[model samples]
Target: MTPTPADKPPSQALFSTIAARYDRCNHLFSLGIDRYWRKQLAQTLVLKADDAVLDICCGTGDMALSVLIHTPVHCVWGIDCSETMIQLAQEKRIRRAGRGRLRGKTLRLSVQDAAALAFEPGMFAAVTCAFGLRNIPDRARVLAAVFRVLAPGGQVGICEFSLPRFGLLRSVYWAYLSRVMPMAGRVVIGDAEPLRYLARSIDHWHKTVRLEEELAGAGFVDCHCRLLTGGIVTLTVARKPGPLAAQPFL
Candidate 1:
């Protein structure tokens, strides 16, 4: 059955509740590899100087910050549904600016839903989302919105958690996700439900959707997927067909 927005899980509230400890928990859970994953997604955009970028589901602005730090884009606009997450992202942007690291790049963040992006058509050179797609119920709607906002030749890069493909590693990883992750979440944040929900979401996403095929269905060309860290994470890159479609960064 096709899930509607009403079928969406209560992840936004859960994320807001853990906003303060979100980064710490992610680092702990991923062994600090989350940063590397974001970097990879950022670079996959192949952003050029003076290009404007949009990051949807831009949790805590880490993905936007990665683009600002790694690419020469003139500005990045980030949107998220969680107000707390946007506030934290704003705080991080301010901190990065104070450290004189932004190099005059701009980051504009707001609390906005990814399914209904409030922007003009073809407004950005690239779009990115990291660890955000799994929680969205109407992914086709969001991808359509993403496709509409991207300029012709623009690209989209997504980073998501996936079950490992190898048998032994898959078993070990599932154990860590299903058991250790929840226990650690309880110890660190006094909450186990969110981590449990995370495991379930990853499982559901893996079993139900093929993101690369979804991207193609949304009128994107040159779709490609790369498994990072032994398929524990997948990076999907695709392009809106145009002159730049030939120059993908996958």
Candidate 2:
């Protein structure tokens, strides 16, 4: 059975405690490779002019902003369970707007649980989540919510950490995850518990979860995964059944 929110206080509290230092720790821990991963996920969306995109678990709006900057999407909506994360995302939107980087595109962010999206059905052309799904105890429910909100033929791109298939690489990556990452998190965030949880969650997901299969079960077709950075990360892309409407913008 899927766990309730009450049963998952650690995950939400972890994010809240580290929200301010989240972006810094992310970049530092990943050696700045996460930016490229987000860009890769954004490119897979193939967003078109006037296409609306929804970003689930969009902490600090990085993934959503990447989509807006990299694609010609009309609007991007981001939702996160952590209010502090959502506030930081809003601050980022305001700063980007002040710098004229938004190009008049709309950016909306709110504190909403991924398992229960509040948006209308078939409201989005594409959906994205980066480094977030594994934290949710009920990822299947979140995928269902994503499937419901996406239009027919809408695409979904998910970026997640995974163990490398190559034995040596996997060992090395595991060491870094188990040791160096949490150590760096201690220095960056002043707490190692969240980073430790991150490592454990990634390990658990890599060993047991089949995201592509889950996507298919959630009514998505053409589900596939592409490993990046020596399989340290996986980008899973899937499409809803039916005619795809958005053409790539020139």
Candidate 3:
């Protein structure tokens, strides 16, 4: 646990309140596409057998688990500011541990803020965040923090929702958000406020180009953004310059 969160921010705290049902709601709303987005995001990591990974705002460890299963990484650390979320992660981690799915790789959990990590400089080989950046207000700070802990040559994969912009899809998406989504959330989770925030965040979030610029400004080189599922979701991958990049470009 590195410089962990003593106080949960309001948005994260709201996540805590819904932690028990959060995963279910997400899967339902995304029609299970969230799983595919997470898989694609996890595939962006530059993992080595001896490399360690950090998943900030890991929520329920979905992406972190993906990293573990998708690559032969040395270990994984999944952190979040919401205790309830972390608690759920712990349970899942324990179950996976007993099932041998961990493959002898370490998976640690911490209740830490994404903007303020506890690990030392260049402590991780890679870092990834999925669907969590939209909830974070200080995304720049979190990016900087990710840059700090990631080793040179390490990569960061960020998967986030963006508002739809295409013609008919945009209209249908907005209508779903305004009407069907809230009704689904309320019916399934007894709350629609969180879903509302999720929609609003996407509506106001930085578009792909702006997000890439922000990542580059934070010292992440080789930044790239890929749109998925009709541009409603974006997967951004950036590399931290390191020994390989400096070795006299062949």
What are the TM-scores, per candidate, against the unseen true structure?
0.94, 0.92, 0.89
Candidate 3 or 2, higher TM-score: 2
Local error of candidate 2 at 167, Å? 1.8
Per-residue accuracy of model 3 over 167-216 as CA lDDT, tens digit each: 89977987787568978888998988776666555666643237788888
lDDT tens per residue, model 2, 122-223: 999999999988778778899999999999988889999888999998888888887888897788878887777777777778777888888888899887
Which segments of model 3 are wrong by more than 4 Å? 1-10, 98-101, 206-209, 245-250
Model 1 spans > 4 angstroms off: 1-8, 98-100
Best by TM-score: 1
TM-score between model 2 and native? 0.92
**Which ten-residue region of model 3 has the weakest summed lDDT?**
1-10
| Model 1 poorest ten-residue lDDT run | 1-10
What's the C-alpha lDDT at position 210 in model 1?
A: 88
Residue 52 accuracy (lDDT) in model 1: 85
Highest-lDDT candidate: 1
